[model samples]
Target: MALTNSQYETIMREYEDRQTASRHLLEERTAEVYARVEGYRGLCESVASLSVSQGRKFLDGDEKALEDLHASLSSLSAQKKYLLRQAGYPDDYLTPVYNCPKCRDTGYVDGSKCHCFKQAIIDLLYEQSGIREQLESENWSTLSYDYYQGDDLQRFQNAVKECKNFIKTFDSDYHNLFFYGTVGTGKSFLSGCIARELIESGHSVIYFSAAGLFETLSRNMFDYKNKDDIVSFHEDLYGCDLLIIDDLGTEYTSNVAVSVFFSLLNQRHLNKKSTIISTNLSLEDLRNRYSDRVFSRITNQYTICKFTGTDIRMLKKRLQNRK
Candidate 1:
């Protein structure tokens, strides 16, 4: 979710482009109106003059200036509408249009990030989350108990219950989830279910495979020349509402990776932001790969759902081939 300066600039440049497009459109409409609508130019000029005069007169303590300006504007508006209709155009054709009416496509409203801007970020993250397509078919509503049995079924049901609770209370409190088990034991699928539900309800979510996460961290730590890129990447990792690190212990690990991972994990815990991590590594494997502190932190603070079952992906593929 952390953007390089160029990536950040790309989004800002889009906002600028939207404004420019809107302005050019208004200019074209104004020129068209002036050319086709007789007396429209004069009406616009009169309104402009009235606006300036009204502001100046009000500043000079003319108490009736605003009232007089309103009456004049209303009269001018009627004439303008009549002129546009005579020219076969709408009355408000010259009114400015914007991509985001709330922010005028400036990406900020009331000096905070606008809903449109936040949605833009969410869209970007959706593309990067890696589970976007899977979510469509893997959500809770599409889940089937037929795929599980015995101990696996019991564990799966329990995990679903816990995830539902997580979703229900997500706004009231903050918590993290750690999913560890055999490969294809429904870890990432359940994670995707949680992600889809929260995102549909308007929470910011960023997902990274362990490999992608470490690659980004390494790129920021050693490959980037600007320190701000490194800082911004860390800021993004810490700032999102939910961060999912999937397939842990599958990445190329080094000193830098371990350091960044531990730091990121610790900071998120301190900030009380929810995180969901799924890994094929067992508890003992995790302790051996990462430090005991990292293992201890997760075990102590996160709700653990241990998964055990046959590989569901292989089974599904085999079934598909049969069909």
Candidate 2:
């Protein structure tokens, strides 16, 4: 999803704060070292002067002067290192400390976003999703087989194993998953488990309920005023490592929604990105709701897992009431 202008400002402010803090820290440490080490302050001045002299000599095409200045600078550098060592400091202790060395805390490298920047965006998106609390309670660590019984239990166990296996060996070549079941049968929970695992492993994930997902797409596609938001919205939708559409068939499916949905599935499929769709709809329902081409792509490219059992939410409520 697209970040508002304020959100973008917040991220940029954070990056600026990091750089400012690093600079302040380096200045403080350098002052402390200079106070403790005699002659170090004078040594710094000499080094700065020599650097300026070297630059002028090169500009003047005086090779001999440049060579002498370089030698002097090298000797000064060695002396500085020796002094720092004697003062019980690392040789590079005065250098700026960056949270992300790749970007030097700027959030970009060579005009492209660094991994840390992408991570910041993912964090913001998760916060915006409003499902953080649900995910916290329903992730992999809390998943249990005690909620199932009989053949339902066996299928649940098998589904859990397959989900874990999917996370363990996940790669670009991995296929998507279709979790179809009645309400409260752990389909969305399993999707959350996989999302949590992959996100913790440094993958980008965007999870949306079917209605919310379609609404965002519809707004971006049709709203002229928020046209700028469309670019970032599309980028995250299509470019994230994994996309999870929970309760897929619950949206108000207009012609625009259906067309966009088809494009989303087709684009992600062609890009080899994985998607997990949890729907409380049967295969026949899916065929009726979506086009034949959409059904064909899903059946051909996705691992279909059919979930069956009593509603776990009701079971939990009954147990709680008994208590």
Candidate 3:
């Protein structure tokens, strides 16, 4: 939710590198064209020299000088483009380029952080959340259904349709997802898919396993010395656009963990922030383990997804061994 000073520096350095690279590329392109296009350099110099003189004359109340400057500059620009094409170069070969043209790689627009900068902050946060690399292979780009068949395939397809709908309407509607089923039934993979899609769309997403989620909560609840880290950590968990808890119910059972979990659900629901939880626990087991209040919050606020399919991982392993 908040970028640390170090992250800000890192993004600035990357922008600096982009600017340097763009400048170097432009210089090289300019030099290459100048060497091949006869009179191109002189034309460029003439345009610059005319701009200064004409600008001064215009300041001195010479309207004719302004008109002449405009015509002369337009003619020179056309000639420059013709010469570049004759020399087999693009007309805009010498134009400045940027990885992000909106801010010209400056990471800011009109003194505000650009969209690219915000996305960069989210990306770094994703890395720190410990799911960046995993998402690369689990997202939409890598979606596959080879391990599914029969009713399982139909169930998976239906569940996927709902997931897609959830993502599609995510901006206009505040909805949470609860994926509950057997282990290795693509529950976690689906969670990653949603996280990846939202993250790429420039929404902030934080992914944590149930154990890690509770562990961080436990630390924040008890660790008074590291007030800064605790505050930031909790803010990220509560304020992120999406928070994913994978393998829920695997965490150590304790009153503190339950209390923390209950509070997290309430705070996120109150804020209208979305949360996704995937667990192997059945509905009855969830109610028994986490208490009725916690279960009630989830059932009321989350769209329950029941995953029923062959264990994709084990199916893949078996298929591999057969091969």
Candidate 4:
């Protein structure tokens, strides 16, 4: 969830690129209008000069000059409006032009967020996530209780109930959850269900594997072209409405990677951002792999949900092989 400094730069650079593209396109259109309005410009200038001269005469007590000035102004206004119509531009378009008329391309309007900024964030998410193919697999409607079966049906049912309750009560202040259990125990299914609901409710969510997070962080740490700084990475992690990190302990446990992981987790805790971390590693293994600091933080900050069940992947593979 933490975006590296290079990633932040990419976001900004994307915004700049979009802005430049829009400006170039608008300039082309404006130039065409200007080319066709040369005659209109000349007429406008002549009318204004005459109006000024007539106004001087009226100031010198000439009543006839005042009448002439008013007539010239009326003629110029009508001609300008007519010319604009002929050019197929709105009458007010010529008054004050804007690339984004709604927000004037400032990314904000009247002290409120602008549609342009919102669009930029969405575009960046789409570009970076690459989750289009997997998104449909996680919808709430696709989840079925029949998928999780065992002597522990009661426990599975309890998890389902808790999940539904969590969705119903979800708000900005809800505590993040860590689903710790064996694989094939429906942790991923429940996490996906939460993702679908949160996304539908208009909250930003990013779901990535723990290994993926480590890989991204490691790459950003060493890559020179990537502009995202450590701070920016931390900011993105905390800024998201919901972050679901799956397979928590699969990453290479280098000293640096472990440190970075704890930093990300700790910051998310402080910010109170909702995170769902699904890990197959037991609590004892977590303590052994990382330090006591991590264990303490996890205990203090997250709601731990223990999952236990048979290996669903092996069962699916066997079934497929049989067929």
Candidate 5:
């Protein structure tokens, strides 16, 4: 499921929009700082003139004049420093600053990666998938089993209890889980709640529908016109704390997509990394859609969670329409 060129362009445009937003924010902050620092403009002009005059005196080979200018420049620098301290400003108060003061929003500092840039990239990638808003709106507190009507209450409660226990003990070494159920069941919600908990705990978690992920990875692998590297997709998937692939078997099944998917899952399993896959497809459907090797790996390294419920979305829709 490769992304169309248009989709890639749209994603890049969204990235550009975020970059523009950061620039505007920085510009506003700079303006605010300029207004806060009294006589800042005059101080800058005076310093510039003194620097120019010092250079001119040096060029004229006048030792006394050069020494005097050096003393003057030092005195000015000290005065600026004292004024900044008096005003409760940092030494870099006059510098063009960014929202991320850590790296000054440069994305990196001193040959090391910056935290803000990493978070920004993660935010942009998540936004590009168009699921950020939907995911953010879901929480465990809102996930109710009451909507799972006409079901065996005892069995449903047991399942919920087990899932809750698993989430509480979730760890990088814990077995990955494959959630199977019909459409509109609570499979995706449970996974989302787990993701939310993990993310809130300071772990990096990437949640993407199977189709969206396949399209993103495939495009990065095939599309060469973009500045983003396919290795980035691989690194994030493999290197992140957790990866959740939802709605598996919904993507256009292809040899390439299957291969990439298999490799990704296999590598993560070998590294003992965790992944949560929720799908409407059963084990038979999974076996038919993917290679036996992939199925075997999943069964061996992952836990299988069965979701039993009616279509919660239909109930919610009906309830909403009544209002």
Candidate 6:
């Protein structure tokens, strides 16, 4: 869920517009109040003069003058409040109205991104990845045990329990999950279930097909034109709360892809970020395709879940045909 330059620019522009609009609104409200209230303008002028006089007195080491100016300013504030009350206006009618009080329309609080900014990123991610639509149909709420039979059913039940437990106790210490088996065996479905739950719980989740993942990295590695985009893409990959890579073995395994994959796995593991990978390749195949180092990391760091049985998609299709 990396934001492109355009998206970043759009968000910044919106923040600027919000600040401008709030200032304009405060000015307009103040102008209207000043025009209707006779002493309101004079009261504002007196308050400004008092502030300047207090600063000068403080610099000149005149403690008595500073104290007198403070009292005068307080009296002027009370008079302004009284005037506004008589004019049927609230005490803070001229205050700037911020959409997000935590950020004060700045999109950052104490130098970190505010909740509103994170929400904006999430919204942009949904638009780019279409994960919102997938989650609606594939989440745990929509999961059906009826899709599995006998041993497959038992495995599915265990996986569902494990997935739930993972979500329940999820933190930076949580282990990564490796869902591996034949095609259409619900590996991707189960990963989606975990992703949907974590995302709904306000955790950031990024999903990518293996091909898409590799393509992004490979393109960024070779294309020097969009260097900033490459940084943003990698930042999201390493920084998201959860990363899901579906159909891991389907990617074209170029040297660059393998190198990037290893770096991704190693960085996330060291950072204690959780990842869920669904692959049709077997453990033996994984070792053969990826290097021993990559295979070792997956084996050592991930909770391997093996899916087996007939293809659930085919079975569902058959049932539909019979009906």
TM-score, per-candidate, Cα-based? 0.80, 0.69, 0.70, 0.67, 0.63, 0.69
Question: Per-residue CA lDDT of candidate 1, range 96-190, in tens?
Answer: 89989999999999898899987876666566456788788879887877778999999989999999999999989889999999988889888
- Candidate 2 lDDT, 98-209, residue by residue in tens: 9999999999999988999888876765664446677787787788888888988887888888888788778735679999977898999999888777766657678899
Give Cα-based local distance difference scores for all models. Answer: 0.85, 0.84, 0.86, 0.73, 0.71, 0.83
Task: List candidate 2 stretches off by more than 4 Å.
Answer: 1-13, 21-130
- Report the Cα lDDT for candidate 2: 0.84
Cand. 5 Cα-lDDT: 0.71
lDDT of 1 at 56: 100
TM-score of 4: 0.67
| Model number with the top lDDT | 3
Q: After superposing candidate 4, which stretches have Cα over 4 Å from the reference?
A: 1-23, 33-38, 43-101, 114-133, 150-153, 167-174, 199-204, 218-228, 238-241, 308-323
Query: Candidate 1 — which pairs collide?
Result: none
TM-score of 5: 0.63
Output the TM-score of candidate 2: 0.69
The lDDT ranking, best first, is 3, 1, 2, 6, 4, 5
Top candidate, metric TM-score:
1
How well is each residue in 1-323 modelled by candidate 5, as lDDT tens digits? 12334434554465456567777775775576567767655765787898788788878887777778778878877776676777787766555545566765555689765776556545544544344666686767786667655554554565567567766776624668888877877778777777666655545677888998899877877677765556556666776667889999889878888888899998887776788898999889899989988899888878787776668789789999999
Error of 4 at 254 (Å): 3.4
Per-residue C-alpha lDDT of model 6 across residues 1-323, encoded as one tens digit per residue? 34446567768888999999999999999999989998899989988888897889888998788789878988998999999999999998977799998999888999988999888766755554447788778887778877678888888788778788888879635688988887888888888788777665557688999999998888888888888777777777887778899999898997778988999989998877899998999999999999888899999989888888789899889999999
